[model samples]
Target: MRNTISLRIADFLKSYPPFHLLEQEELKSIAEEITVQYNYKGEHLFKQEDPCKPYFYLIQQGAVEIYQNENGKEITLDQCDEGDLFGLRPLFAGKHYSISAKTLEESIFYLIPIQAFKPITVNNPKVSEYLLSSLASNTHTPYYTESPSRGNLDLTSDIHELQTVHYNKKLISCSKDTTIKDLAGLMNLHSVGSVVILEDGKPTGIVTDKDIRVKVASGNWDIQMPVKEIMNSPVICYPASLTASQAHLAMMKHRISHICITEDGTPNSNALGIVAEHDLIVSQGNNPYFLMKALLRAKKTKDLKKIRRNITALLEQYIKSNIPMTHISRVMFELNDATIKKCIALSIKKMNTPPPCKFAWMSLGSQGRKEQLLLTDQDNAIVFEDQDEASYPDIHTYFMELAKNVNKRLLKIGFDYCPADMMAGNPKWCLSLSQWKEQFSDWVKSPIDDHILLCQVFFDYDISYGELNLVNALADHIFKVTSDLPIFKANLARSALLNPSPMGFFRQFLLETNGEYKDFFDLKKRALIPITDAARVLILEHQVKNINNTFERYEKLAELEPQNRELYLSASYATKVLLKFRTRQGLMHGDSGRFIDLKSLSKEEKVKLKRCFNTIGDLQDLIKLRYKLVNLI
Candidate 1:
């Protein structure tokens, strides 16, 4: 029987491929009978039409190319690398090989007996499904037919075709006796460049900004000139339902910038609104000022909540409009930050008095990092001044009361309470400056479980309000303490690598098999958190303070670590792409943007996700090497 060496091979095999579906004992039995074959570069394992061998191959190292004859031409079908399985088709077909399998480079492969594999597949549905799915994905078919059959078929239809129609609500008009100045005032009030001369609400000519600039403004006509003096005869009018494309075409056909929307299709009908060429472009949902204003004026939690809905709606519009994710993320972050600040301000007003002493309310975790796209949980803290011994307790009590109100209101506004309860409402987290320093000192010196938990939660504290000095002092204390504790950084690095990559061997998506999110990929836990944790740890190691945004942190890290600059930049790019993807998914699915439905993604999206995984893999490698975590796993 094969011994420990073969068992090791079997154990590795059991982690991936068809072997993973076998019972442990059954797999070990197959492994015991397998032969390890080594091939040099350009060596052929099997040629076309050769008799089927008793053994099927699993690549141990290097790569093997599978080629099939197409008419008179030899076409390479696939390349199998380490841990990849190939040459299994012959076992099932029970015929001579249909393709030639040759080594692309020097390689080793475990040859499992076809006789052993056949028995295991007899009862293993998962093994059968996995093998069949892999085979189907590797085969070439008509592009249109192949895609619709795959799970990602729906994403093609998800691409929204921009609608042509738009709202034109800016109407302009003036009485016949109205002076040129009054006509101009009417146009300016409506923020338009033209005024229609309406005599008894019938067909009339129109005055444009060009007329004002040329005749009235240039002193060619008196300021008191009547509407008849400068108005262009025969107004151009269209119905309100004109699509954006049609509007553009009409404007181009007539060589005009504006189209007057009238009650009827002609200039004889009363004008309702004007559709300008610029309006069509701006109508594609480039307006964030409206949402910002709504947030600022929001008086109650319900009002803000209603406006928050609008913000998300606006976000969906932005994504659908194909705006750059960077611009959208920044705008969305600003709006969310402003909303939180407004909440805090309103909360403070509801309190008995202004804060007792100087303190800074901080947002922690994703909110702290400004990478929170979909609202998740409330992770926040408070840092008050170090008061005298007698007054400290009273001050702490007052801030805790304030925090309670704030946290409760925030919860009402839709942010879930932190599962760990690491919120400002917790007296343990809401502390004075000296108390915070003492807390950090304890965490750094001990590095215990609870302390590590706190470190992970609180390390990303971002100043949200109060005295900047108070927050700066807290950051200074953290840097001072953590700079001396390399072990803490190492612990953080280990934690960052806790989630193994979401990509399996052979580059297939690794999805959650069970739990609340069965069959869905946990983008937050599997992808985002690891990168965020890594960025925080790496930045802390660099003694950088106050930069909590994940992409920004990585960009800063790239600046600091020149050797790993490319990797860091790639990490930053990946973080943005994943965040944008999550935001889009959340907007589409109406959830917290944590779980992604792999079946809904298109092939291009799948490729983008794979690219993100590559970045994650590279970053994980850096973390492992830097922390010497090879032994930890």
Candidate 2:
């Protein structure tokens, strides 16, 4: 009897490697015995010390990371993608695995059983030579490394970029007889958003959260109603062997979230699993799992710094894929936040005892706003709870030591030190709640040029760690002082309008006139800052809390004032476009995205940027109107 699954497996295997060297009958025979396996991101296929299975693995789809544990640091030896082979060493050695192989992304693997294939290799010289070549060397990975013998494995590198629509393998499904109440219970128990209704071991229909919300919760049906009444029949089905682009197109065409995978890519076959938009997202280059896996196993600052390097690769991929800048920023923010929190925790462990007082590490400026894509200088401060005057010295010393360690570790992890000495390690920036309040009051009361500049950077501070109540209280105090004071607000707004529309009298991009970036476009100064500053001041005027992100602030503003929705939305879109532009420029040049060479930009790129600048002009003009800063401009 022929199995469609094995045929599909054979079809994939015949495209690459020693399998490609084999005859059709021989490949089919081997594929029939091949075991299909699925693994999620970060799962170990085989550990370094584990005995080899009867089979070596081929990455049918997705990536496999082969890494070595060296002195407690996981050094990534190689990453294998589609049609790549690994674990072949044990076949010849008959010993424990040398390196740990794990999934870097949600993957489909075809297991080539060694026991069943001994005769085939004995007959085929090319197959034996290939297998021997891999097992012959300790560090040689045929699919990963390019060498004289490897001779262009012809294995696709871009498969990771555009193939394999990652499906949810958990297979959360229900029978047609299942009641609405029972199905809901099952969904809750599994913590899944949808369930496939199965009949005769094949998917017949599907039910999702929306179905329950509209059908049962909206008073349309009782909980006792069978799911057959609710489940949408004629389910959208595809084979497990589908590409990411294909799945994405299918999902969009069908207007559905869940795509059921069946053996024959039809409703009549056995339900294999599902593919979701969320799954595709998780499997993509923006995958936090890969970085987090590296993060957890890291024991030294250099290891973490290596992880940061990988983050650049992820960012490059995201930008290349044309993923929304807003989404990319959020992922980058989460990764950076996690890295900072881990750094603080590591710092605390370095201390002799626990912290003497509650403290919050605040990330100021770009990081605070969560728009930090390209890493630049660190801008951070420490906010601790007020302590006894006598005990202040000891508490301050302990926190100072911890800050020094964190700052050093952060520096090692690729964040350069602030030129102006604004880090928490500095005594002036590190302060108690009362001291911070006093400082903010002083800034507001003074509103001098230097003070305003300091306020622009400091006001965006977000608590990275420690006591939240202290930070919340400080936020309230800052808002209370600035909410009623018009001069402070107007001054801040005026400064936001200082950078004039990012275009000079010639209507071309206003390039920096002097310094290292002379004749280059100041991406951050000329465009990004004006919109960011405007978002900050306007959102503060509305007294809206918790919207620190420039784009998000504009989104909230659009919601708050429906009349100026278009203006706020325009500003929001401009911010996103500029951020993406800056991030791409930074990635290309390997800089902080502050400076851009005008010669590098294409005509379309230049046009898009100037359009965003026009929106910034509109924003700066609105600030002039609202704050009555006609004289300042």
Candidate 3:
């Protein structure tokens, strides 16, 4: 029998993980052994290196401050608020506490006996995993996640743009009184493009390659004169912590290169390093379309890798500029397509001869649909001209090798290897035009979950490179086959409804119940995927080919159904708004915009999100009614 107090404790524990994984009986039993403790504000729970407590603590109310002594100075590590679990790491590790935990305010804690807790988690993998994550500092609110995209999507594949600029640490600077000739000698010896003029070890001015050309070489000033006479004053300075995107933007905004790094983030401090525009271009990949041209000139795969870094920065720029996702997607898709084509062209040159036959490299799934805002796994396939056994083996070998090179290069450039092994390199996907038609026909006729999934992902493909006729022929065959199979359309519609309504009965956003992102709202899963999935199924029913974009699909739906025009138009607006919202979140957090921290949202943002969910609910209702999917649900 459980007491009221024990039951209440169990209820609170059930909301969080490890504890959440426990059975009701187990929870009640464990809760009975839990002891309650109270702490005043600014009171220490445990100091660093203190012996581990017999009980692990859970925050019942208020907050806990976790800090560590780093180099004789206290550094705050994290804050554990309501329902947050702490002081469990040392108990599990059989060691002293590595961090000091204290109360941030007047707090109540439920201290569970480690003896009771250990036995419960012994056989529970999820509990054990959650405990390990907590120990590793991967803390999240009981029913919430920490950052966007940590729930599912890894929108920040290239963290380069999000991180601090990798500046040149070598200080190529001279005293302000140094002669220009001496500064030139120092610059030549270091092979630096710019020379920082330091006054009392602090950067005061900078002289660049342009200054050397215009001011000194042009005889506006003599090289033998003091460097300060020709040096540009009030040098653009930034802190060492300046991000790649910020550095790039600063250079463009100030119309100058070579931003000097200072300790205090001002020229009043010692010059630490110099970050040039050329360095930013070399590191962050200056512009997206320019990076596309750079891809063409790339002789090695590493060059493509560098340009891809720039592409991520450009993505940040696009999001910050509030560019419509449609325009951004188109530009990004073009850049990606251009990269693939260039890689293929280069691979052909590496071969003993050109491709024996014309073929089309097809970008499937998100890339196929031109909705890839982030660089995810490469989902692609190949379709070649049909040929008899005579020329078949040669063409097959050529395309296979080409795909292998392209896939490997794509991986090197940031796209993860698709876990499902769905790429042109896979023989099942890499096929002749007739074979691809057969594949599509088989999927449509079968209409099983697996087959329907294949239809959804592969059917959206566009010609990335090679022959257009091959892809067009395949697309024509697909619409023709899908038109004949109503069951397939029904299956897709069911899949769209699988995402569930994003909002709850109380009009609150439905949060994920578990996984690493427990309690975190999945914006992509709940909102974006629902809309995109609905769009895909609806567009497929109308036999509308080539519009893989979610918003565009809704737009086409509006045009097709005038009676349901308002609903379709509303879905279109909602889709665009949701995409923009997700991108903004992802860019802000440097994560995939899938999982969102609801608490971090402003009141206005929350209202906008709720409004969007309302629209999504309506769209889903439309899906249910139009497909007659009430029975399926």
Candidate 4:
């Protein structure tokens, strides 16, 4: 019986929560029976211990604070804003309210009649389970204890339980008949300090660089002497996946610096790869310099692509090495950025001229922020100085052509083309400075749908190349126009808050229900972007300029907002962890770091993800409070 508006509410609600279990007709019926209530700022919807109303509430517009008395003090337990379902205790437990629900600002809420909804809860098993789980979570018992059967039992194991030692997979070997010069050439080519002498795919002996130095150069053996002459026999071998402790014991037992990884755990089983003690130590330590250098020297897109494979190798090494996540992220980001920059430089060289009249290419979204470790779609723009109207077409043509080449090159470099086509190649994005100023001004002043769309992309402008001054000028214009536009800030804040929390009311992971990523969690959109966008808006509101790095911006914001420092710091840590998780997932899957298979993650990873979600929940509450964006949508 509900009209389009109520049906839309029903449609939205059915995408989440207990409502999601309802049939379309049932949802529409519930939607029709619901009463829409609007409250002004600081208004109370219900007070603690008040008699239960006939209905539970869902935030249709603004935020509602759920406050509970803990010990002697009233503390804010949680905040329920748009699309958030609240006040379900009455329906579930038939009890008076244990918490007070109040409007943080002007708010609209849909009150669903418990009498009508109760029957569906009893009829739908999924609905019943969802409500029970939701109530369990809100009741504040330890999450794992609520369902002992489903608890993460694996967490009982110590961190050491997950420690795994990886060895090199490729083994360098040469036949005994090979000349010493050819053997040395092979060793130099593979950058290995030693080579195994194999007779018919079986390791017969090994010759190290030391043997070459002491035996050959010292005149004990000739340079032309066969590797078999200087080779050390009785080589040791071990199975792959040896633990660090076991590897140490094996090395001690054998008194050898290198262990040959072979089939069936013996030297006889054909060498797979050499695991030198030095290589093990290096793998255990944080050394990104080699990878960074590789990134810098990468000439072709294919070379960068190859280096990207090493990034995963390096990441696996780092995780095993126990490098701090922050250090890992910093180094990985530097390498990723360097690759992009090299790609840009190469793309520019392909251009006909050195960009007409000085322009800066800016990367937007995650890349602009330099938090992108896993390859994502490129979101970029081109900003040049305002040229005379007569010269505009020519300048625009040049930049557009350059952008086309750059975008194409980036696609080849592994950054998928933006689906919305929001790239420098787009005329809307490839703009001159004065034009950009006008564009941003319009977005700030009017903020129509298109302008809002543009703001989301353009707001995170980071200078990738060309004149820094031109980019700064654009930033100045944005601040100048937006300083007084509270509405614009609110809009951006609302956009940041658009993604529902990564967790459901039952505190289960929210998975993509549709698209190619169905059943997978969208860490990028649901988690990373929310934090990144929130940081950008807050930084812009503080008039902080040119700081596009999301985590750094949050760190800066923490200093600026003392009262919210802890929340911001937690946000920063969460961002880093989530970025690492996404990077690892992407590296494993060989795709953009977006959809993560929740089932594939270990228990520890799931727990870490949930912890990050807690931070996101807290940050979303803060955004809702600070921006007063509750009623905007």
Best by lDDT: 2
Clashing pairs in 2: none
lDDT of 1 by residue, 92-162 (tens): 66577767888866888999887777777667865764454444333211011122111322211111112
Candidate 4 segments whose C-alpha is farther than 4 A from its true place = 1-287, 319-322, 630-633
Per-model CA lDDT versus the true structure: 0.74, 0.80, 0.77, 0.73
Per residue, candidate 2 scores C-alpha lDDT tens digits across 14-113 of 8777688889889889988988789998799888878877788887776676767778755545456566677887678567887888876689888888
Each candidate structure's TM-score, on Cα atoms with residue i matched to residue i, is 0.61, 0.59, 0.57, 0.56
Q: Model 4: per-residue lDDT, tens digit, 250-335?
A: 77887777777777677778777777877765554333555566667777778877777776676665554333344455556566
Please report, as a residue range, the 10-residue window in candidate 4 with the lowest summed lDDT: 140-149
In model 3, which regions exceed 4 Å deviation? 1-285
Q: Is candidate 2 or candidate 4 better by lDDT?
A: 2
Position 598, candidate 2: lDDT: 88
TM-score of 3: 0.57
- In candidate 3 the C-alpha lDDT for residue 277 amounts to 81
The segments of candidate 1 whose C-alpha lies over 4 angstroms from its true place after superposition are 1-195, 198-286
- Global Cα lDDT for candidate 2: 0.80
- Can you tell me which runs of candidate 2 are displaced by over 4 Å? 1-162, 165-286
**lDDT winner between candidates 2 and 3:** 2
